[model samples]
Target: MTEILVVGASIAGQTLAYWLARHGMRATLVERAPRLRTGGNGVDLRDEATEVAARMGILPRVRAAAADVRGMKFVDAADRAVARVNMSRNGEIEIMRGDLVGLLHEVAEPEVEYVFGDSVRSMEEDAGGVTVSFEGGTTRRFDLVVGADGLHSSVRRLAFGPEEGALRHMGHYFAFANADSALGEDRWVTMYNLPGKMAGLYRSGNHAQAKAYFIFRSAPLAHDHRDAEQHRTLLKEAFGHETSWRVRELLDGALADPDFYFDALSQVHLPSWSSGRVALVGDAAYCASPASGAGAELAVVGAYRLAEELAGTSDHQIAFRRYEEGHRELVKRKQQIGPNVRMMVPKTHLGMWARNGLALSMGLLARSS
Candidate 1:
């Protein structure tokens, strides 16, 4: 029997465990959080990943967990609709990130060992296997170690190197937090764009609380990703010039939110996803920067493919190479975010007006269909 240690019990880690179990290999999972994480904004499922979910026997549960959000209504500062972008336009379903994670956890639990509230401190590899040290004071050896963790992955840092130059910051920032549902319409996401900034509220028929969003364009600023107060202050400074469309109210909600998630819009672009007895998966290897709308897909599909390759061989190095070769092209395409950034936060007021026109056209097409 081959033993493997998977880090980060996120979408990627859960899917990886499920597929690895099916492939006749079970693994232990470690998460930094005290328990399962249940706080996050909306996420989508699409592409080949849809099939992966079905094969895992969780597609129905995923469909049932849909947020039931109709679409996004781009609004002006006066709280009037300018145009709408239909959610169902892409033939994909949107589920809350937490809900999806939970579903994956539920399905993968019995077949896996879970270590919560702790994380990897350091790792050392040898001819026999890789030995990992945990922050909680323990060491373990395994035939393979996979970092299914997110962008700031400890395994990637230990196995590969620092992430300073590997990350491509998209010259923008975005944040999301719980909001008062009454502030937004049921089943709709209300968005307001002004020049280089965007503010929005997402309300779903199934959720009692809506989610608030704020995005702005700027060069990289010095800040800690883990500091919520610092993030709120920076957001205030960035949106200081805007007095439009509930910016004040959204900011207030964000500050009050205990689960606020704020970060620079960035993608991870690494030269390779593997080294020696360790390898990386999902955002740790190739994050599409959230703007690509492919995080969930990439995470699941990449894990599934890695399991497929590893199942056929004892040579994990070759399996890692095969996984990279199989998934690298799509990763490259998804990391191209210039057009996505321009669409996300227009550089000028005139550009926003143009965006409004484009939205209206898309809405019209949806209606006609």
Candidate 2:
């Protein structure tokens, strides 16, 4: 039995573990969090990823957990709808990120061993196997080690090298948290865009709770990613004075929420995703950035193809190469859309007006088609 150690129990890690175990490989998944993280904003299953989900026999569950959003409305500071785009016909299904993660965990638990509240501190690969030391002061050996950890992957840093690749910051940062649905809206996402800033609210179809998103353009702030207090202060300092509808209230609610996630909107560009017996997947390898709206899709499909390649080949070298070759085109296509962030998050009043006009025109064209 080939023993595999997978770092980061996010969607990618869980999915990869499931496939690997099904292929007669033993996989142990480790997550830094003590339990499954929940209450994230909705993410879409689009393109080839939909087929991948169906093959995994989770399409029905995924569809059942979808946000059921009919459309998204762009609103002005005064809360008037400037444009609306019907999302039902977008050929994609959206589900809360936490719900999808939970579903994947449920399916993977029976087949894979899980270690929570622990992380890989160091790794050493030898001729026979890879030895990994955990932060909890324990060492283990595995036939292979996989880094499914998100963009700031500890496995990548320990195995590949200190992040040599460029982390292209998209001149913005985003934060999301669960909050009270005081906006009294459902079945639609409301968005407000200002100069180099954006605020939005999304109400879940299955729960009365809502998710709030905030973005602003600024130099990268120096703070620990795990520090929620610093994250709250940064958000407040950035948008505390803004007069957008219920902005202060939402900020207060977000800071008070225990599960707030804050990070820069950035893409991880790497020359290669693998360095020997260790490899990377999902955002750890090629994050097209959340602005591209393809992270979840890429994660699911990439994990599937990666596990398939590994199962088909005995040589890790050949398997990693084939995985990169098979998936690089999709990564390139997704990264090509990075330049569109300016249009998506306009930086001036005139730019916002232009964006609103373009969106309205597109909405009209979509309706006609």
Candidate 3:
């Protein structure tokens, strides 16, 4: 059996390991978090990703746990819905990120060795295999190493060099945390915008708890990505003074939540997904950004494809090249992202009015049709 090391145990890493083992390869997954990071915003699964989930026998579970969000409603300060954009598409299923992660874990845990609360510290690659040093002070060797880690991947830095050249800031930062369910209508994502910022509440009919999310336009700010306190401070500075449209209540609740997620709206644009015996998958190599709504889809399909390629060949180089070649077109299309940012956070009052008007027109057209 070929030995493989997969970094990060979220959707991508778990899916990769599961597929790898199914193909008669041995996989060990390492996660920096002590446990699974299941708290996150809703993610969508469509097209090839949905097919992949079906093959894994988790499609029914995913559908059952679907967020069931009807669509997005743009609201005013007085809490009246101005326009609603129906986000439901025929072939897509939306589920809370945490729920999906848990489901993936249930399927992957049996066949894969998991190392939580530790991470890869360094790696030395040679003709035989790659020697890995873990943060928990252990050394191991694997025929191949893959970084399914998120955008700020340690393996990418270790193998492909620093991320500065590959990371593209999308002119904004966003945060997501728990919120009071009563703040928004059930089964709807309610959003309010002020110039270049948006504060929203996502209320799923299947979930008792709600999620508060905020996005603000900004140039990149220098800060430690792992510092929770710094994330809170930055969030406060961005929306602390806003007294409109339930912003204060949402902010308060978000700050109180321990698992607040804050990150720059960024994408990874790597020239190559692999270096030597090391390779990258999912957000570690090509993040389309949240605005694209393709993170989960890309993660699932990319991980599966990577594993499939590796299983088909003994040559890691050939496998890595084939994986990238097969997946790059989808990544390229999703990375376009287009006007999603502008639509979410209009830069001016006139722009907001125009957006609202367009949405209202679309809603009316759909109703008449």
Candidate 4:
């Protein structure tokens, strides 16, 4: 029986634990957060990830919790709809990030051990196994340690070295939170954009609340992601005084929401996602940036492939190589879409106008087709 330690009980970590447990392997999942986090922005299941979800036996649950977003309305500063992209229920399904994580966690809990409010403090891996020290002053030895933690992965830092090829900032920042959907605009996402700035509201089927998303271009603000005060202040400075339609109201609601999430739009690029008996998965290894709109898809598919590869071989080295090989192309395609940030958060007046025009044209073409 191989004792595998998976850091971060996020979607990736949970999915990996579930698959490994199904393969008759015992895994211990550790999360720094006290418990499962809830109320995150909606994430989409697209491409091969949809099949992966079905195979995991959670596709129905995911679809049931899916946001009833009919389409997206792109608007100008004046709140007039410039374009609308009608989303068809074809190959894509959108669910709240929290819901997806909860589903994965539930599937993994009975089979795997879970430790909350703890994290890896240090790790040393050898041919025999990996010795891990936790921040709670506990030590454990496992046959393998996986860093499924997010972009700022402590496991990556401890096992792979400092943040040399770890992260690349994509020249933008995004923030989102749940709020009251008093607008009565159910089954639709409304978006307003200006030069280097974007504001949107999303309605989910599971709740009457709407989610507010704010994004802006910045030259990498000096603030810690974990600092709530700094994150709030950054968002306030970015769009605090903007006169866009209901922007003030949305920001006020966001500031009041205790569950607000703010982070830089960044990508993770690693030369190698593993060393010795330790390896990394998902965003910890290669985040394609939120601009790509494939984070959830990548996380689910990457975890599946990684666990499948590990099950195929007894040697961690071979498994890690195979996982990377299977996943590199997907990661590359997602990263290639990172530059689409300009379309989402245009930096100039002309860029904003062009984006609006292009979206309008696309919407017209879609209607015609």
Clashes of each: 0, 0, 0, 0
Candidate 4 C-alpha lDDT tens digits along 233-324: 99999998897688888999999999999999888988888888888998999988777878888889999998899888888789999999
> Using lDDT as the measure, what is the rank order of every candidate, best first?
3, 1, 4, 2
Cα TM-score per model: 0.95, 0.95, 0.98, 0.95
lDDT of 3: 0.94
lDDT tens readout by residue for model 3, 1-369: 899999999989999999999999999999999999999999999999999999999999999999999888888899887777788799999999999999999999999999999999999999999999999999999999999999999999999888888899999999999999988899999999999999999999899999999999999999999999999999999999999989999999999999899999999998899999999999999999999999999999999999999988889999999999999999999999998899899999999988777766666312212
Q: Compose the digit string of candidate 1's lDDT tens values, residues 1-369.
A: 788899999999999988888788868999998998888888878878888999999999988888898877777777877666766747587889999999999899999999999999999889999898999999998999999889888888888888785788888999989998878989998878877888889997778979998888989899987788899889889875667778888888788888888899889988889999898999988989878888888899999999999998899889999999999987787677557668757889899877767756665413222
Top-lDDT structure, candidate number: 3
Per-candidate alpha-carbon RMSD to the true structure: 2.1, 2.2, 1.7, 2.1
How much is 199 displaced in model 3, in angstroms? 0.4
Which has the greatest TM-score? 3
Q: What is the lDDT, from 0 to 100, of the residue 30 in candidate 3?
A: 97
Cα displacement (Å) at residue 146, model 3 = 0.3
Off by over 4 Å in 1: 358-369
Candidate 2 residue-wise lDDT, 54-104, digit = tens: 877889999988888777777767777767767675669888888889989
Candidate 4 residue-pair clash tally: 0
What C-alpha lDDT values do all the predictions have? 0.86, 0.84, 0.94, 0.85
